[model samples]
Target: MVSIRSVHGSAQLLLDVTGGVTDIVEKMHRTIAREVNPLNRLRDMTGETPVAKQGHTYRIIQSTTSLLKQGLHRSLDGLSAQEEWELSPQSLKITAALNGVCGDHLEASGNPLAISMHLRNSRGEKLQPGSTSLSTMIPDASPRIAVLVHGLCLSHEYWKGHNEGNLGTELQSAHGFTPLYLNYNTGRHISRNGRELSQQLQRLIETWPVEVEELTLIGHSMGGLVIRSACWYAGELDLPWTSRLKNAVYLGSPHHGAALAKAGHLLTSVMRQFRYASPFALVRHTSAGIKDLRHGNLLDDDWAGVDQDDFHPDYRKPVPLHEGTRHYFIAAAIGKQVWDLPSTMLGDLLVRLDSARGQHSDDLKKLSICAEDCRVFEKLNHLDLLDNKVVHEQILGWLA
Candidate 1:
């Protein structure tokens, strides 16, 4: 067993390693594309160069950068069990920088990033209140509908994977459940939002002015945890709506928590000084995201509550443990086959098979997966759980 301190240390190492190789990864973006105006701009600012002449310099910079990034990602990807998930602030900064650079260049070239961010957040998007639609709020009967919650760092659009997209839309269309896309800043405190979500679910159940038949939930990654937290609160409330939990499925939930998240907290604590220099300090620490991430894992101070004007309703304390045995049904996906473990765990890139499962207690009463048996998706990764067709088809078929 690794100590939390060691977990932090491993994450710090991961960050340091990733940070050192960031420029290279960014270079990969510059390369493989025909554009080279940035190189001309850099040269003209410092010296003088024709736009045509800038291609060579751009290629050189991009070449060197790509090699470094490829090497780095491979190394990070190759980390062993004890260190696989660790991330440092340095790594995150590198990742953030990579994200910014990629997003900026892509936009300049008239291409937006993938994943359409249609929904606002857990708070819901702006809609005129008076007029109602079927998707907005079901009418005339019990509003007991299907609500869809997305995973961490993702949007409600995650569920609408049609043609290699998420299945949010399909759930509404095919499953006959009112799909409510739950989106939030996953970097925030899990339990706090859990309560807020619980309140939201309670309101969702009560407000529709109709009888809710079954409140089915499907969560991926951190979304799974949030759903569980909400359900735990609802069950405790003993409300009829709470009893409507008919089917719940988790794609790749880390029921025992991810080693990587905890490791990331450690990385920031170590490099907070050197990296947090100057005005980058505020944006780096707060707007950039470490503040909330650290707080979520109970590592850094609570930034959302203290700094970001966080708001969450209070409820009974969560079990803080996965005890899905009480649910009407539960299902989870495991991508890796036993023969491929250590080298490849058929996980959704981020979540592991063991952690995605329930406690090893030899009792079905304590089963983490609510299913009498689970469907193991042999070759899917974490992202594939949402994007892959086979996985979605299996889910739809099973539910049907």
Candidate 2:
């Protein structure tokens, strides 16, 4: 069902978008006007002269937009009487995509569209730790637990493909491990999710129906970063769940950083230099989560006080793999072979080969994953790593 909050959130987002576009158009007009008029241009360039005045038409448009926004808000408040309505699957997908883009804004505005982190069953039902309902949900719980985390903008449902077999089911049938899925808002900072995941895992372990003897973590893309971040926080907080963790598998994870995110940051930075282009840059404000992917930020300290849009060198603190856990990394490339240019330049079409393998030129930044523990698959894209039989087999092999 679609909550009333979603409706209110959507309305607010539309207003914000239209308002931003209007501002952009007005700014562009003003910039053009200043350029065509030498006197106004000189005034803008020099502090001694007064700034150019805005056009009367632009002022009228701004006032009209404000009035419309206010009216919309008043109208939406009336609909609050109806708490919820049917929400389609297509709408869910759109909401997830929106969260990936501007989740921080939605969260800050208290929009119900923002997703919260939770543990879900294979059926996509929420699982609460330290509750009898957990045991009721999974009557046949096993001693060994395998926690699977999906990537950005994805839910636990991503793991269930049309294929005959999935990694979770295969693990259950072969290794006697019970599989659980972690569903979360991919637009939040990795560190924040990580900290929460750590606490959740602790509660799950403490409340498990059966004693958990071994724990395995598997993550794809940004999910892997969250797992790493969680492990870091677990150590700092001395969480007992860490003791049960034995294996960690990273599938197409950008341990160093994602190439596409870096490129986006660069483009946004360049666009901000021009007044005409600057407004366009503001059209799509990326979330703090996406910004963290620029350098695989796993700690709050990485971006606590820094301006994300400004060009800054990689100053992220190095976080090595856990001491007692066996770490495995899987990297994918679009090329037919590992030596191909595409494989080296565009690993999986999103992450770079070196970054996926956690191989950095700087010794301090490197994840130091053993060569034997790392595997590279050619001719596969990023999402392909999720359901491909070969990839599943490789993960199973690593866990074995």
lDDT (CA) per prediction: 0.48, 0.85
Candidate 2 lDDT for residue 74? 75
lDDT for 5 in candidate 1 is 32
Scanning candidate 2 in windows of ten residues, the lowest lDDT window is 46-55
Q: Residues 286-398, candidate 2, lDDT per residue (tens digit)?
A: 88889999999999999899998898999899999998999999999999999989898888999999999998889999888788899999999998888889888888888
Best by TM-score: 2
Worst 10 residues of 1 by lDDT: 109-118
lDDT of 1 by residue, 1-400 (tens): 4334333334443443344345444444333232456565466555465533454565576566556545644554334323433224344333333322232222232221211122221234422222354234433233435556666655554565635855654555567655566645454455555666777666556555456777777777766767777666565555445666766777776664554543554454444444222212223222222223222222112232353322222112224433432332222334345346531343444555555664433343234443544665665556667767776676676666
Highest lDDT against the true fold, candidate: 2
**Which regions of candidate 1 deviate over 4 angstroms?**
1-144, 235-240, 266-336, 342-346, 360-367
Alpha-carbon RMSD of each model:
16.9, 3.3
